[model samples]
Target: MSDGANLRGRFITFEGGEGVGKSTQIRLLESRLRAAGLDVVVTREPGGSQRAETIREYILGGGARALGPMAEALLFSAARIDHIDSLIRPALQAGKWVLCDRFADSTRAYQGANGKLGDDVMQALEQVTLAGVRPDLTLVLDMPPAIGLQRAASRRAAGAPADRFESEGLGFHARLRKAFHQIANAEPRRCVIVNADRTAPEVGADIFRIVDERLGDAAPAPAITR
Candidate 1:
């Protein structure tokens, strides 16, 4: 059902570990796209549609910690199904640029890399859940785990606590960074690594340049068939 008609609009995803400014860069790109008079729909995985948001809440509520990696991946896939059907598919079919904060890559990194997940399981989930919809381009905001964690902790609201993933130790985050690097290396065309340690404006400028250059480039090599 998610294999809607082929789309003309671009699908861009911003991916990174906690507090790597994925949200900030997304805003910058969205603003540029709107200024150029394009229709853009911004959404986030595991929490885009109403049902998906419920899954996000449960997953971040601390109870799901006890659940194994496979169970967690299933929950994320369930949310992704609702999100693609209810929000992502329609936006793409209508020819609106889709900007998502995190997509399947996050699942692969957080649950797959950091947890007990294998590539076979991750790939199969993608084939089923995505149903041939993959990002035209993915911006991987790369940064050290220690720096990112510090930034994330500082950004948290006063009196608020870190989420389950955020509360993870430094070692977990180091591997998470490597996991993202692996994804970028595997899909060179679809993935671009951006240094997230720089100032927000500097990072924003780098992203804007890449968007301008890459968006006008050729389409992503066919990864999933329609």
Candidate 2:
């Protein structure tokens, strides 16, 4: 039910800081879509494809941190290129709704905002990497950085150190939240800000409603009986 009805698939990306429960909600939404008799492909950025997963390991393992933000952004873009080529594009062409955990917006928020990369640079990278393919809808889960970090910490295994981004201080996360808000504000039609402080079911219900309102009408109609 994408605006690009000719593409035969809808792309929905979830954006938020760490511990916003994107993975959980993606699974819930996937199940709902399956129950609704739609083919769905759930994937994640920086790791969706086999080659991209290699990049994900290196970047998340803190190997790319010292290389600086610009380098990190380049690496993420490289991964995304492979991800789209190897997985996302094929599935969409096959008429499967694609639910991606994170996408270019994360790069815009994390690298562009925190790394001080200008909008021009970000736009250039997006143009090269995306090549006209973009999510039909983006869900930005909103919550305080303090609460989100605490939730992130609680979910981690004992003595398991934080990943590159998660290890950052509260100020970094606060800025991340602000950046996501700015993205939603700038693109009201393509992005929706959903409060993440509530229970999962509550959040899921709201998400479903939004999805239904936006894309449900475009779902393929059922066949009539003879």
Candidate 3:
């Protein structure tokens, strides 16, 4: 993994509407990459570093929803700035692949497209928050909104309440799905839309194959064992 100290690590982000199995896919990919002798750092947006997590709690806990999408977008960007500086950039600089559950694309989808914030504001926020850092690959997990919401509800059935985004109406999620597809279409080189309605193992296999095909050269040599 450390064969090339100067080599910058790859950044991959998983994106989707509610309950699209992003967390599960991220875990699966992390395991595969680690087994292949790559140093992997798994993180998530709205919260990755400490300060960002605090922002995450506030935003998801419904504190920012009432303030409108613009406020939420700003908060998300603030968290992202901290996340990039505190955790993500450092890990990548050390040659560790960063698998993020969500990133700026979420803001683009939820706030810009669905929230009706317009492209100008979204572009400005993206410029400020991301600087020059962008994901090398983004796996947009595509699935029906109704089915995804059902899965989300099931996951939250253990006496856990839905978060701000999760509590949105079905129409909101439908638009969110469309927004993600639009993003994938706009940046085909950096984004791949994966059908996420299948089983975890099946989805994992496809994701691994995509990673190997697209980034095999950058991956570290598997560790030798006796």
Which 10 consecutive positions of candidate 3 have the poorest summed lDDT?
Answer: 1-10
| Model 2 C-alpha lDDT per residue in residues 149-213, reported as the tens digit of each score | 98999999999999999999999999999999999999999999999999999999988988887
Model 2, residue 190: C-alpha shift (Å): 0.4
TM-score of each: 0.93, 0.95, 0.94
List lDDT for all candidates, in order: 0.87, 0.90, 0.90
Instruction: State the RMSD for candidate 1.
Output: 4.7
| Candidate 3 structure quality by residue, lDDT tens digits, 48-124 | 99999999999999999889999999999999999988888888888889999899999999999999999999999
Give candidate 1's whole-model lDDT.
0.87
RMSD after CA superposition, every candidate: 4.7, 3.7, 3.9
Better of 1 and 2 by lDDT: 2
TM-score of 3: 0.94
Q: Per model, state how many residue pairs clash.
A: 0, 0, 0
